[model samples]
Each structure stands twice: as structure tokens, then as C-alpha cells.
Target: MTQTLPLPVTPLTAAQQTSLVNLVRRAAKTEILPRFRNLSAHQIDTKSGPQDLVTEADIAAEAMIARGILQLFPNATVIGEEAAAKDPSLRQKAAEAELAFIIDPVDGTWNFAHGLPLFGVILAATRYGRPVFGLLYDPMVDDWIIADDQSPTRIAGAGRAERPTSVSKPGALETLSGIMHYYLMPKDAQAKLAPVLPSFSRMGSMRCSCHEYRTLAQGGVDFNLSGILNPWDHAAGVLLCQQAGGVAKMLDGRDYNIAIEEGYILCAADQGTWDTLKTLLSPLYE
Candidate 1:
């Protein structure tokens, strides 16, 4: 019962913020938890290839989140994976929205369908197309990783933590070590990265960038590297990272803008890791 006030309520009342988070969490519990691992073969769909997957769980999860969010904020725009894929206009709206919910109903849809417990819900609020608040909830773990502008919160059932999470400094690019999640990058890139660091490990594509980002923010992981990822994938995660005293940016050292559909994302625990990664990655882009 360590009760404290939620921080950085900018454009939202504390009540609204709590309500929004509860709504997303409820949606996940109602629409996603029951369906996890209950999928038939037909419930799965191919997006790019066998590796890039979607399932009925993903669509159902998105719908539940969208409906719940829209019910509370009627004027609030919503950008979801299934909906955004069907209508390119949603992407445009996301880039221009003042207040909106970016939803990834079942971030690790593949894991969910396969009876793995790695997936979770990713929901974030954005103003003028910039992320402001984020929540990543894992139902199975009964944990919620939340990010407001002022602080990061990790709540599991009755327990919660409000603290800043950061990374170690950059030493040598050749000896750098961190966690990487390659969505669709070739394995060769993973192998080549070994020489760039003492450890460059891969955390399989769980489809939930929010969870990965939360892990980084909490110091559970060092970094997350991804190629061919969209804003919906990292919007909430990046915001959480910032709140947790970490940094999430493009490899080019630019702020990650939600205006774009897809780009490479690099998450580091602190400025030190960021500087090291930037120096090492610079030549590769050339």
C-alpha cells in the first residue's frame, strides 16, 4: 500500500489518466487474456511472411482497446495496428492528432497464439503527434509498466515502483554489450554485431516492443534494436524510456517522430550507451 500521486498530468486530469490506464488494462484482460493460446490455425494471418504474423487475438485485442478508449474520449483519435493497416489515413491522423491513443492490443500476438506468455498491451497518449503517457501491461504477470512525463511506474498487483531507470556509459564500440530485438533484420547483422560488442543478444520477436522497452527502462535489459518498425510499435515504449531516465531515438541521433510509418529504433539505458551506439552505428549507415 505505498500510495503516491501520479506525476506529470499535463492535458489530463489525474482521474482521466487513471481512468484511461484502467480502461486499456481492462480491455486487455477482457479481450486478450481469455483468447490467449485458444487460437486455431485459421486464427493466424500472414502480414509479410511466416515470421511476420498476426492473429485473431491481435484484432480482437485492438478492437477492445479502441472501443474502450473511444468510449471515454469520444474526440480522442485512435491509431491501432489492424485499423491502421486497413486505412493508411489512420497513419496520417496519428501524425496530426492532438490527443489520441496509440494502441497495440496484443503486442506479442505470435507468442499469445503459440501459448507463450511474452505478449502484452501497449497503449499511449499523444498530443500533437508526440507521445505523452504510456502503459505496457502484461496480464499474465499482473504487472503494469507506466510512463507519464514526470516519472515511470511499474506496478504488479498491489506492489508498485516509481523510480528512474538508466544505462551504463559507453566505453569501446568493439566491446559494447546490450540486448537487441530484431523484428526482421537478417541474422547476418546479428552475427556481425558480435565483434562490435562483447554481447549482442537477440530477444526473439515477441511483437511487443512496449515490453522490451519496459525491460530496458527497468534495467532488465541494456537496449533494444529494431528495423522495419512503425510508430505504433515504439511510441509508448519510447515515452516510458524517457520517463525512466533513459533515451529512445533513431540511430541518426534524431528524436523519433510519430509522423513516420516505419524506421529503425534504438533504445539505450542512458546517455553513455547512446553515445557509444551512435559512434559505432555511424559508419554502417554510410
Candidate 2:
């Protein structure tokens, strides 16, 4: 993710950035927190499977965040995961938009639904299909991890100070550790990836990309491999990883884009670690 980017002529201005981050915090405070453990059985529903959940909280928070984004950048296209799921065409629209804000109201919906405090809200501002700005907000802690194409990743919140962050030092593959998504991949792909797991020190899925990327950016994790390529899920985290001095790309060596339909996203601490992991994962794409 730390590869050089074709940066936009202008990233979000300081005023805009501050306002947008506040908007996300407001949504979490007003919409998400209220419904966290308060979600009634009737307020929750399934999308793809039993574990794939959407609560009233997700819907309300997305609406709030989306509306606020529109007010600030009236011409920018805003695509929320929940909305795009109801209308697939929106994904294409966001991908091609001159400026688009991709929103994941709750990145760990399953965890949130089950009363886990590990969920988060993610927002990515892309120019055309490339992420130009990214925000990963943890509602529980009321703080955020943020980055732009040209800035180092920073952690900040209401009264908290902001500080730059980076990834961990590279380590041997057997000494390296991180998260890998398995169950979500196709059965054949799962079989191909399973054998590769034991080669690393540790591998598991938190069912949440938000915290996974946050951990990687803060030097707590060496790498992250996710099975899906949804824009809302990876766009922000990809930029977060890049700004934190980590390498991020599709298994095939392509830099990430909102237009990518399917592939694993592999993010690692630095070029050497990324190259090694990429070579090991090359077979899946090959």
C-alpha cells in the first residue's frame, strides 16, 4: 500500500478533512452507539448468509454519514455498502465518479450485532477509482486512524493529539504474523490457501477489516490478506496501509482500485515482506 501514488492535484483541505472526520464521529455517536447492544431482533436482517448481518444501526449511520458528505461536497458521489448492495449499479457509478466517497457504516457488522466492541466506520474519498483520502473510525474509543495520498497515517480524536504511525519491522515468514480470510473465499480457492496458512506464525480472521488495517498501520500486525474486493471494504484500508509505510496490492501485483471485482488484497510492512508474501500467494492468482 506504500507504493507511490498518482496523487490528486489537491487532497482534502484541512478544513474539509476536519469537518469530514467530525461528521463520521457524529454519525457514530448519534446513530451507531444508540443501537449497539440495543438492537432488537426485528431490527436486524441478513444479506448473504446467517453471519452476514445488517442492523438498524448500519442503515441509520450510513444515511447520516452519506447525507453529511453530500452537504459538504454536493457534487461528489457517495456510495454506502448497504445502499450499493440494494443497487449494484452504484458501485460502477462510484468507481467512475470524478470524486466519490465510499462508506462502510459498520465494517464489522457481525461483531457489532453480537455485542462486540470491535466494529468501526470507514470512509474513503477517491478521485476516479483511486483512493485519495481514507478514514477508519472506532466508535468505541471515539478516535480515528486517517491518511491522505501524500501524508503519513495519523491517529486522532476529539481532544486527543494526533501522531504519525507506521508498520512493524519486517520479520522472517515463520516469525511474521497477521490475519487471513478463509471461509469467504470460494471452496477451491480456500483449499489452495489453507496449506499456505501454517507457513506463517499465526493466521486468523477477526471478521473485521477496520481493526485489522488499524492494527497493521500501528505496527501490531505484519500483514493482512482479505478474500473479498468490495470497494467499501478495502478502499480506505488500502490507503491507510500505504500511508503507514506498508505495501498493499492485489495478489496479481496490481495496485488496488475500486473497479477491481475480485482478488485477495495483501498488505505487508514493507517491500521485502510484501514481495515475499506476494510470491507465496502468486499461485492463487496464477
The sequence of per-residue lDDT tens digits that candidate 2 reaches over residues 215-238 is 999999899988788988899899
Q: How many backbone clashes does candidate 1 have?
A: 2
Clashes by residue pair, model 1: 107-207, 167-269
Model 1, C-alpha of 269: deviation from truth (Å): 1.7
Model 1: weakest 10-residue lDDT segment is 197-206
Give candidate 1's TM-score.
Answer: 0.85
Which RMSD does model 2 reach against the true structure?
2.9
Model 2 / residue 209 / CA error / Å: 1.0
Per-residue lDDT of 74-157 in model 1, one digit per residue for the tens?
998898988887786887787788787888888876677778888878888887667888888787876677766665554444
Show model 2 residue runs off by greater than 4 Å. Answer: 1-6
- Point out the worst 10-residue segment of candidate 2 by lDDT: 5-14
Query: What C-alpha lDDT, on a 0 to 100 scale, does residue 138 get in candidate 1?
Result: 80
